[model samples]
Target: MDSSKIINIIIALFLPPLAVFMARGWGQDCIIDIILTIIVFFPGMLYALYIVLKD
Candidate 1:
């Protein structure tokens, strides 16, 4: 796919909140990603991947 997406995926794997922030800006998606990351890292990572791939 796109290089930026690949980078975002890598970032998402390491830090989901940051990845969401980069993709969606300071919005609800970013907040949700932060919460999910705080609650459970795996779920947050998955959510971030979904968000990134969706666009």
Candidate 2:
């Protein structure tokens, strides 16, 4: 992966919603990430990693 993806991964691990927003822009994915984060952090982080690294 390039530097950006690497950065996104790091961000995803720490802040799932922001990472999802960075990867997907403003959309349903962002909302989902936010909701996941609100419900529980681990799942949100995992989802963020998936979204960021799936390129």
- Number of the top lDDT candidate: 1
Task: TM-score each candidate.
Answer: 0.94, 0.95
How would you encode candidate 2's per-residue C-alpha lDDT over 1-55 as one tens digit per residue?
A: 7899999999999999999899889999899989999999999998999999886
Per-model CA lDDT versus the true structure: 0.94, 0.92
Task: Measure candidate 1: CA RMSD.
Answer: 0.6
lDDT of 1 by residue, 1-55 (tens): 9899999999999999999999999999999999999998999999999999998
Clashing pairs in 1: none
For model 1 the local lDDT of residue 47 reads 97
Candidate 2: misplaced stretches above 4 Å?
none
* Prediction 2 global C-alpha lDDT: 0.92
So what's the TM-score on candidate 1? Answer: 0.94
Off by over 4 Å in 1: none
Q: Candidate 1, after superposition: displacement of residue 9 in Å?
A: 0.6
